[model samples]
Target: PPLFRRYQVNVLVDHSESKGAPVVYEDHPTYNNLIGRIEHIAQMGALVTDFNLIKPGALHRANGGYLILDARQLLLQPYAWDGLKRALRSREVRIESLSQVLSLVSTVSLEPEPIPLDVKVVLIGERLLYYLLYQLDPDFGELFKVEADFNEEIPRTPENNLLYARLIGTIARKEGLRPFDRGAVARVIEHSARMADDAEKLSIHLLSTADLLREADYWAGVAGNGVVTADDVQRAIDAQIHRADRLRELVQEEIKRGTILIDTTGERVGQVNGLSVIQLGNFAFGRPNRITARVRLGKGEVVDIEREVELGGPIHSKGVLILSGFLGARYAAERPLSLSASLVFEQSYSGVEGDSASLAELCALLSSLAEVPIRQSLAVTGSVNQHGEVQAIGGVNEKIEGFFDVCKTRGLTGEQGVIIPATNVQHLMLRQDVIEAVKAGQFHIYPVQTVDQGIELLTGIPAGERDEEGNFPEGSINQLVEARLIELAEKQRAFAAPRKEAGGEEEEIKEEEGGDERTE
Candidate 1:
């Protein structure tokens, strides 16, 4: 079919292709619909599953010009990849029956007849499909050399934000409601960032976005206002939360199990660990929190827990930065350090390694040994530096909200709060409802400029006065970990990544230009 001229841009934000078969029997009730559906499904050039129902050689007869194959489906089918490879290699196309699938030589021997095919093979799938083929298949470069990458989000700059604002306005007006305030538009963009993984494409999945839009409509109607204020956005969030039956149960369970700890009564010694995670969208990930590890001035400040625990993730890079920073700043004296230590989640996973948690971990460690109690109800999430400065962490909204949900479920004590990196304050787009809750003292969010500041905020204690020598009043977990980090840094030159400097060759990534896949 020719491309629809002047059609609005349609983004396909589907990832289901990585796992299962494409839905073939789509919605259709009328005879016209049935005919159209059948024809379209047939044009996919697939071997019909139920041969008894279809006419002989129907797919071959129909999709002669184009070939459509599900990447996963074809891969799962026995000998499918080989058969497709053979067809492309021979410059021929064949739709073999189940029985004829394995009869290789008799079907086509020694350069017999090449099925001349000007076929366009379309693999309806995820980017991973093509990526896997490029890596493992030697002859992949020869077949189906085309690619189509879709945008998952759009630019969130002021200009496009205004356009998005207009779209929101249109929705408001269509529902016979009021327009949105300018602040509301900015809030939406911030929410869009949280929705889209801060990507250029706002990835709050279409379904989620549609749901939000609908709820926004309801709020506007309820408020009896002509425009949707930031308040209405809050209302929609609260309404959505109220609908989450399972989440409600899970939070209660965590509370009953004492897994959701609250307000810091006081600080312990020698423990710290922190982690942060982002959701695909709203309440996607529960609020990110910190882990703490405490060391008694020795026993190695360098916690290569991942190497020990075999934890690996994309976020490890940030963790190393935090660890290294602590070592350089506190242990610069290269003093011999030996201190017993223990580090665990304030609220976390058994298998974890995401850099954002490093700050939390450091804080926990600092608080424990420093004997400074961290706030029990306050959860912190971010990455930190050796200099103790806070760095922006991803998924700030989801993380904050995640903790909020847990606290809410546990029966929000007035002290319930979330602590985030000072740098991440700009990213704050708490649901209008959540913001209101904060205002009502039902929840709280605190931003910290440094690990010290975060710790101070967490434990309700001033981070303690630094001495002339610049230490955490000695005997503190911060001082101990820093000392250990310095010792470890001196003893080992940590190889951060696979680079030539570390004796590893660089990986070359070749991206396809336009729709033409250039094989390397």
Candidate 2:
């Protein structure tokens, strides 16, 4: 459902769940009258407070039953948790100047009507909310003992999808519309999959569904159609594009003018492609990658790399493991080695998290060590394992587009492109400019299922075949990495072993001590 519709539903559900004290407005006597001055209600040992008058204003009025709150909104309120907890524990609801915490408003002690405290409180919010609460608040376990998490999309089984389509039809009818074309329903399901962040379930989130339906309405009205059709959905998307026309216009103007460098013609040494994720609200854009690293191998197999400098995320830890694993397996498979490598997101400044850039880091490191030039055009993201497979990641679209935006702004000369996981292709819905660029042969997006594929794409050369023994060609990156790891492992063992004495100094010391003892 839409946000507003959801609010309406909550109200209906709350009332249905109870015959409680009525919802009082700010001016209602139950609320307007001072708690201390209330002789009638207070005399019954039921007193309300004004402490949380700011939020949970609904909480006080509907105190005897359920108090529904959005977890995100509650967290946004300053001291909201403490205030709510106080009210629940005191079994008293308060009305007060919302400024009690931050302002100079005097804290008013109100009548302590036992917060009947039996009302079931339901908090609706993102899944992250639960994790945040548990991680930050030690007292959370005591308060919210029971959690009922709602699924965004219900399972998209035959029965469920059929009912979901019926639900969509029901929504269309409620809008005073005729119906929807079957394909339009399928589009909704596709969108639902995107919204739910899953494939198995056909459940598109209610909020997203409501928005799409509303947008579909606008398009239907435009087309003068009695029944909303797929055309209407496409029209809505177009309408949204029009709204963003201004941004697109500026970017395109810049691209045409050649103010930015987006083409991949000038390949640089010690650099590999990577992806960056740019999140705007619930929508995200992925940009193509550029990772540059300067590396020096030392005595042990450890990759001492700072993430903030290399990948730009707040130390996700995975980045470190990735680089270490690649180095251990490829460079020094037989030994540990010390290494100093500094990797950087060549053009990134903000929007951080994840060691997803670790694969790119490894690529850069190997390129630097082998003195090979990575393809300037192909940027890569995804955490690589010891076996060199390209893993799937979130914000794939954002990372792709962010790079694309930079490249496009510079100039996509048909060969300008990025390489990502093959699984990410379905998520590709390019913006108008990007789609146009692709159509015009100005840009490209290639997906790879394996590291060899990614490396081949990035280097613009075939990654050589492995021998019968599963060894890469001697001069290949794999060989360089293996040699390095083996050297590091040997260094680690040598350092770990006890050192041999140069002149048996301990024996001389023992003899001197024995002579001293005889003299004594």
Candidate 3:
């Protein structure tokens, strides 16, 4: 006894459910948006409502499924986060608009029955948002017991490379775009690694890669190619660079037009080029700044011009202070360091921050004191401690490439180079052309561990250490700095001696005058 000859099932995804998932991405997540709001109809100049007029919100529609919310958006809305928590905790959704909850509306509204909730709430946001919720909202921990952390990059292995090629193939087929050949896939993977800022890892930003693929496909079609080739991928990358590089070009233009004074072919005593990375939106580029130092006879202090005008950040100020400490410890242990050094980034009008230039600043200060010429063919980056040891810095690749580009513009003299901390060698994932230049002796990279090593490389002079009698070796850079500091101290003493003598004479004359007046 069959109940029916044929049976069929009809399943409909809520039209609002994006990407064919029962998940709701609450972009604005207002109280009325997260919970249902009651609609009203004006009849005879009065408000009226019915059960059919009740509109369901995200919570109602996402019942028995997953509800995705951006924690930042949810918190930005007034009472929306708390309302969502209440629903999740109570396992029921009460349709209450913000006006009703705040008692702002005087007109009558329908009170829809609460719908039982049985759905998983997933919050997608930064780590700061999650930490804030855990610290501020007690129920957040109880509700979100499970956490899924995503890595920014994945390891670049043969297996992963094959998988990534397959992913690109699938995307190309799905989007009805020209297929990418092996060379194009390889180039894209290399670009992905560059995006991650690591040679060993590939970026997980699939959307960005997909966009690149589509653009490459368009260029391939324009060139009348049947498939996307490596040249197409390279052109797409070049176009992206051309589009987002206006500011970089302007900076380079300023450098070339003599608006920003950076020498690429000579040597100066108290100047060195320092590297810094500027982030504009999602694009970041590095530029070299001319850091100069002037030293004179005064109390031992390193005056940071950027900090004086409030352009330098706390870390930069700290680095300058550490420069003072290093001078005191290394050169002034026995004699008073009667030197005042002023450091400035020449021609920089905007706010300058970061301690990555500390090494360059110290090199400039030392050059000013020792009167040793630092090669303009070279630029330097890294932070230095009180012990004068070079420390690693961020954006090693960008910093190196920045100076390289500036030098390349002026023509690579085969002697141009950049000195970086030795520890940062592992982080080197430079461009192929730069690598070729290095290999062909058109450019160079010097890795230094201590201030001694860096100073030697910068000035082509040895930074001699103290002997058994605490005296620097004859004719060394350190000896010259020490001798200069001694001369300044002697000059300071001579100047103060005359001032003290004049003051004593005035006191004696005042006493004699008082005695003569009393006698009269």
Candidate 4:
């Protein structure tokens, strides 16, 4: 009970009610607001000042305790950081008017004795601001020597998970909300892992978790339920999505209206659905773009149209370059890569960023080179390396659900599914309906570890292995790509052969003409 009593904390400086040890949260830490200012009072006509004229500020109230300041807000305010630093360094909070600081005050002002600044200043900010201050301001490093790093996630062990559920219960009770049933608590923990995007970890974002619990409790009250159940939590989650999913709806509408070309069911050569995530503020969702590739005879150059026009970020460019490496290592070890290919995200006007779409791009390029058709019913999201290994990516859940929603909007064919990196399978905390569909064979999720695995899934053909001579089996995708490259090389040599003969003929005729002129 005593420990529980310790949780009963007082709110200080909440609209100027300073009780107990005053802890200040300076949201707008202006120079005058952070340090106390002097005021002028007119006594009988002339300006006069007394000890009562001195107004205390955040630093004055937070003395002998803690002063919480947002580093971003502090720096944004003019001279606020410098003034705060001076007080901390001198161990005193000074009271002075801005007019006095600027020498604009002609009348006398009260210069109160500086109070001892004994409060601990806690600067909360992102990692960038901390590093910038450490590198740019030497004073920042001297004053702020200790650094406490808070990870976004904690290990999801059984004991930790139980503790997390208990923490949620504690918050619910503190907020005067209905108790969460066992199922609701378990769902919240699972949602925590989903937010962390990891199966073995849970997010420690208490504020967000509390918000979810509060919303679930509200839904429980609306349903006249005494306790919050799993259904209430689901409703709260769905309502949150419904509230913030306007952009997602518009994107889906565009797809349905045929403005954004995405094929939910079909088979096409040199085309595949590439899944990407679009984040607007705190809300993020997945979008499917049609990535296409065209092959021609030239030097081995896979031209990324996005990168050429500076629409691709560095990671996207690197992923495309890795495709070239995969092609050379897999098919063109002995011969020059005498083929030029161009890849583009069809109908996508915005700049493309991550390599999560690289797997789809590679599939499109392979289908073009091999004359194979990729099933357009399936969409893919993954990053690839030079070794043809598929890697994990962020927003795996959104990407899968994005494609699922689109497919559901049109019609959920049994063949319509998504292929994600095998490593991302642990991150699958999908909706109940989706899980049910997968169980009923109405949808599928193929976890692929390598490019070959993904290609086999996409093309329904065996990605055959090489034999004794390091050549792929006949009619395999790799064999077809190699054969196409060899044909292009031969054609390149053939075209150059006639050019060489024509140049020789022109030189010989010029020599003959010079001799005729000499004879004349």
Model 4, 338-431: lDDT tens per residue? 9999999988777888899889999999999999999999999899998899999889888888999899999898999999999998877777
Worst 10 residues of 3 by lDDT: 4-13
Ranking by TM-score: 4, 3, 2, 1
**TM-score of candidate 1 versus the correct structure, residues matched by position:** 0.60
lDDT of each: 0.57, 0.62, 0.88, 0.89
lDDT, candidate 2, at 520: 100
For model 3, residues 1-520, the per-residue Cα lDDT tens digits are 2233134322222555355447666677888888877777888998876665577778877887788988888888889888988998999989877788889976677787788888888999999888888998788899999998888799989999899899899999998999899999999999988888777889979899999999999899899999999999999988987899899999888888888888887899999988899888877788999999999989987899999999889999999999999999988888888999999998888888779999999999999999999999999999999999999988888889888988888899899999999988867878778999999999999999999999999999999988998889998999999899999999999999999999999999999999999999
Top candidate (TM-score): 4
Preferred candidate (lDDT higher): 1 or 2: 2
In candidate 4, where is summed lDDT lowest over 10 consecutive residues?
Answer: 6-15
Residue-by-residue lDDT tens digits, candidate 2, 1-520: 3335323422211455546454432222222221212222242576543322223355555556556666676666666666666666666755454444356756455433333444556666788889888898887777788887765557768888888888898887786755788877877766676555456656556666877888987778777887778778767766664664564455445545655233456676678766666554555445454567776646433342344445344544566566666666654555445666666554455545786776677677777765668878766777667677777777665566667767765666777776767776755544556677778887777787767677666765556666898777876666665555556456655665645463477778999999999999
lDDT: which is higher, 2 or 4? 4
Q: Which regions in candidate 1 have their CA more than 4 angstroms from the true location?
A: 1-69, 94-98, 104-115, 158-193, 197-201, 207-248, 256-260, 264-283, 287-294, 297-325, 346-349, 385-389, 405-416, 439-444, 459-520
Q: What's the alpha carbon RMSD for model 1?
A: 18.2
- Displacement of residue 451 (Cα, Å) in model 2 is 3.0
* lDDT over C-alpha atoms for residue 322 of model 3: 95
Q: Model 2, residue 295: what's the lDDT?
A: 60
Candidate 2: global Cα-lDDT?
0.62
The alpha-carbon lDDT assigned to residue 320 of candidate 4 equals 97
